[model samples]
Target: MIALLSAPSNLGLRPPQRGSVPGVSKAPEALREAGLFRRLLDDGATDAGVVLAGRYIDDDDARAPGHVRNEEALVDHARRLADRLTSILDAGDAPLVIGGDCSLLLGIGVALARRGGAGLVHVDGHTDFRHPGNSDECASVAGEDLAAATGLHWPAIADIDGLAPYFAPQRAVHIGHRDDDEELEEVRGIIGLVVSAADAAVAASDDLAASVVETAGTGYWLQIDVDVLDPEVMPAVDSPDPGGLGVPELTELLRRLAPRAIGASVTVFDPDLDPDGRFARLLADVVVDALRTLGTAV
Candidate 1:
């Protein structure tokens, strides 16, 4: 069975404007309104309820390195999220986590680390690899989550409960980042498999599935940042670079890849940019269609 968990956290992102909280926090409710949950429930997925987030403390021109915004609150929320995920796993249900932003990876990492580890398949338009070592603008956890998850960031968020390196670098596969990504070269050296969006869009789904499956061992966690969709198709993300996958291509890849993963998280879709709820409905359709075959293996 699939268990849908809503993690409405915007704490990971910088503010769209000064003094304003990011609206990605509304993503779960937006997706729900678009019938994502209803369709999943009809298809045998269970509503695992929500993991509420701490209030987002905006980072307005604050380039304070190593000073992650909402440090205490974000840590607390992650720990609490871990507790909830633990229960969902205990029930033997595959988790479909809907996110407010990518920072929820911290919590997911905590849960997976406690579960004896799993491979990570990161599908994003950007690497999310900004760390103190590479950049001074490391305040947004959403953009730096991969670094935090792989234990390349500060000890505070990266080493929660002393479980640093939530997913081993050698067991991780990163797909869909653009070739021009600033962190591409560096991430490639650290991550086991790194595929650019251009390459991933052209590669056979079967081949992509084999790479992730072989590296994932017995179980794996799939994480999707919706910006992987071309801005023409999905512009609701915090950062929408050009040259991304089309909806059909993304849906095909997910169909081939998501089924074998133990759980998945969909992140960075902001309903504020989707005022008419068009993109939300479209994303919902794509997700519901692709994940309906959740437990089927490659």
Candidate 2:
């Protein structure tokens, strides 16, 4: 059985109004209001071959008042969420977590790490490897999430009790980056941190199954960021950069990757960035694609 979960971030630390992003309105609310949620739920419920459960996590990072922005609070929340996911998995249901921010990956990673070593296939435009020191450069909460999982910003994620560094460098694989960087030092440091963006570009294509099997090797988790797509296709993100994978490319990639991994969870952020709600629908589609892919394998 597969479960569909929505970790909607519209409640916390996000711009409440629509039109916050250019040429778009109702993006954040759409996550809550649009038919996408119901559609995903329906797909799960009606798919006889697969049992699906649906729900939404009501808490947001800002629920703690200044906590959402704090790394430790985020980590604690991640741990709690991880516990929830573990419970679901223990009950014999696979959890598919939606998101308010990418920080949710910390929880997912922590849970997977507890089970044993788990590889990560991260597809995003930015490296998200910023240590606490790098926070001074880009202060966006979503920006430092992947770093926190690596124990980079200990203060933010240290609150989670007994949780250790989720995965080592070799266990992690990143794809999709086209933005040029002036921080050559940091860029050079991430040489091994990233896989071939060229490969990521075509990763969602027909051979995605083989690609995922090769990367997953033994066992793995999938982490996706919508910003990994071109802004033209995914402009609702707070930090949408130009020149990345297209929607079909990334969706196809997830379709290929899902079945090979031991477990999988996706982080869908910047729902507020999507105005027409097409982006949210698109996110749901990618998730469904993964589920369908898993179904085929099962």
Candidate 3:
């Protein structure tokens, strides 16, 4: 069985404008309105409900080396979100987390860390490897989540509960990053493997899945940032760049890997960009088409 969990937190992102919040905070409900919740329920997924987030302070940008935007609120949300995921996992169900932003990985990291350990499969358009070590502009955790999840960031966000490096670098695999990703070399060197979207275009889908699954070991957590899709297909993300995958490619990859994952998170979909809600329906369709097989192996 699968458990649908919502973590509607936008604390990790910078504001769209000085006084406005990121509409990513409304993703869970947008997806719900698109009938994802109802469709998943009909497909045997249980609704675990929403994990509300803290206020998104536009001025919360903390570039003070060791601090991140929405420091306390982000930490608090991660812990509470972990509690919800832990409960779902404890019940022998695979969690399909609807996220507000990529920073929700912090909470998912906490959940996996507490229960022994697990590998990670990160699918995003960018490497998301900015950290205090490499750069001082590490204010938005949404842009630096992969680095923080691997314990490469400051102790404040990385070493939560004294369980740093939620997913070991050697056991983590990255796929679907763009060919022009700035941090490609660094992330590939640190993470177990990195498959560029260009590589996935030529290689077999199952082969890509095998590489990630083999390197990530078993019971890996799957992180899918929708920016991995072509901006023409999914321009409703916080960051949409060129050189991303198509819908068929994404669905094929998900079908091959999702059933093997212990849990999964979907992030970076902004309802504000999707005014007419067509993108929401498109996203929901893709998820159900490819990820209905989630938890089949577990």
Q: With candidate 2 superimposed using the best TM-score fit, by how many Å does residue 84's alpha carbon deviate from the native?
A: 0.6
Better model by lDDT, 1 or 2?
Answer: 1
Candidate 2: C-alpha lDDT? 0.55
lDDT by residue (tens digit), candidate 3, 31-91: 9999988999998899998899898887644445468888889999999998998999999
Q: How many clashes in each candidate?
A: 0, 5, 0
Estimate the TM-score of every prediction.
0.97, 0.74, 0.97
What TM-score does candidate 2 reach? 0.74
Q: Give the C-alpha miss distance for residue 38 in model 1, angstroms.
A: 0.4
RMSD of each: 1.5, 6.0, 1.2
How far residue 102's Cα lies from its native spot in candidate 1, in Å, is 0.3
The residue-level lDDT of candidate 1 at 222 comes to: 87
- Among residues 3 or more apart in sequence or in different chains, the pairs in candidate 1 whose N, CA or C atoms overlap within 3 Å are none
lDDT-based ranking: 3, 1, 2
- Which is the leading candidate under lDDT? 3
Model 3: residues with Cα > 4 Å off, grouped in runs: 60-65
